[model samples]
Structures are given as C-alpha cells and as structure tokens.
Target: MAFYLVELTKSVTVHPRYFHAKLGDHVIGRLLALTEGTTSGRYGYLIAVVQVERPLPPGRILPGTGHAVFPLRYKALVYRPFLGEVLDGVIASLTRHGVFVAVGPLSVFVSARNVPSDMEFDETEQCFTSVVQGSEDRLEVGTLVRLRIVGMRRDATEIAAVGTLRADYLGVLG
Candidate 1:
C-alpha cells in the first residue's frame, strides 16, 4: 500500500515563556508542526495530522527548566510504500545510472537494469529512447511513468524504493 492510517503519540514540550492560559493550544500547534511531514522507519511518512485526541491530560513539567512535556496522542495519515506495488510518478531527474521518479512524497529510483530491455540510455540525447511499432518513445525528465516497487528501504526521515518498468503494463504513461 502507498498510504496508511496510523495512530501516533509524541511528547510535545512547551517552553516556559508560552506556558500561559492557552497552553493546550500551543502544545497542539507544536504537535502538528513536529509530527506532520516527518518520516520514521516504523511509520513511513506522516502525510497529515488527521485529528488530535481531545482533553489532553495535565502533563509533567520538568523541574530544571520549567518546560512541560505533554504526551500527545493523535491519529495521522501516513504514506508507506510496499513491495510489488504499482505506482505512477513524474520523472524528477534522469541520470546515467538511473531515473528518479517523484511518486507523491516518495522518491523512487528506476535503475538502468530495471528499465525495459529495448530502451537505451543515449548520452548525447540525454534520455532513454526506443523505437517500437514504427514509433519513437522517449523517457526524459518530467515524463510520467508507471513502475512496480521491487524493493524499499526506510530511514529515520525518508523512505526510498527501487522500481522497475520492465513489466507488460509498466513504463511511460500518457
């Protein structure tokens, strides 16, 4: 699956200066800013802060600096790419080694080997081109392509995937 809905809890710390009447609002604001758009190995990428659970508990305040650490619980929409998934994306960049496709917030790399056998990388032309059925096809930057996710790797802040366009239904799209 490309996207997943998950629940997450995070500790939102409020500084002493902003620890006023509407401290809850401040913490909630911090929560959204910190959690949304972040990626974790376990959670993939946080697409949105779906909703924050209401009636936050009175959090514990650190003694040393008077900073309050509020345990915030909420539901979020996250994007997680899975193996064997077919996704359509725009070609973000083209290189001699591979093509980088921007599939939503994820960057998928389609290496030279994963591309179709008939397509060849032409250094002078700066694209992957092929002649098929009396027509010329070109794969270049900004082209839309459909690829299958063959492998994936997760990092602390992003998810990377290897894609292939060698299948019958995969490759450049209109």
Candidate 2:
C-alpha cells in the first residue's frame, strides 16, 4: 500500500532563456532530468514524472551566478514498501546471519532468526535446507521467495528492509 502518485512542488534552476511562456515545459524537462531514477529519503523511488502545472512565475537571477530559480509543481509515481507487507524477490546473496533479496530498488535481508526453525544453513552447498518428513526443502541463491517486511531503514542513498520467512504462505515460492 506504499505506492503513491501525487503532486509535488520542487525548485529548478535553469538558464534565463527558459523563463518565457513555455517555461512549464522547460521546467518539466529539467525536473524529470533531476528526479527520475533518484531516490528520495522519505518518498522512496521517483519512478515517473506524469504532468507539470502550467506556467510558473519567472524567477529572479542571483547576484553572482545569473541562474534563474523557478518553483515547478508536478505529479509523480513512487514506490515504497511498508512494515508487514509481503513481497516477492530473488535471493541475491547469503551470509551466516542472513540472506539478501533484491526487490526492485530495495534490498531486503531475511535474518537466520527470521527463517523457519526447521531450516538450517548448509555450509557445503551454501544454502538453507529443511528435512520435512522424508523430503528436503531447500533455499539457495537465485531462489524466489515470499517474505514479510519486519523493519526498514532509509538514508539519503538507499533503503534497507528486514524480512521474515517464518509465517504461513511465506518462504520459498517453488
């Protein structure tokens, strides 16, 4: 439920020639150039710039640098994951403490404690395995898994999540 498409106002600095009647178009171009593919600390990934509001007022030039600063408003689509949200991702790597999964722009870790108690790490194979009756269920690198987000931390450059595979309908998908 963390996906959102909403309007946001941001400042863009451009050359004075872009300050005319078609200012909105130039602002939109510059805004997309700056924000697309960038991760906002709070908003998560800035996926797409959908629309730009019409003609913002021309901004004034700075004393030393004659750059014009304009406030541009626009709508965008962003993706973020919340606690308890179940997501599917491929196992990227494994360590003694946990395994890391890549879900789009986010990287999630499923700690050893969060894995099912029945499963144990296999050092030789570098995978997790569980003996269920007479059968063995295994999880290895490149395996598809369904996990629930237990915790999250965000910084200027990245987002990290702590996940659990111990719940019902959670763990290796196939």
Instruction: Give candidate 1 misplaced runs (Cα > 4 Å).
Output: none
TM-score of 2: 0.85
Kindly give the stretch of ten consecutive residues in candidate 2 with the minimal lDDT sum. 54-63
Q: For residues 3-101, could you state the per-residue lDDT of candidate 2 as single tens digits?
A: 899788888998876657776677768889998888877888888988777656667687787788888788999997888899999999998688999
TM-score of each: 0.94, 0.85
lDDT of 1 by residue, 27-123 (tens): 9899989988788988888989988899997889899999889888899998888889999999999987889999988899999999898888999
Query: Which residue pairs of candidate 2 clash?
Result: none
Off by over 4 Å in 2: 15-26, 133-136, 155-157
lDDT of each: 0.89, 0.85
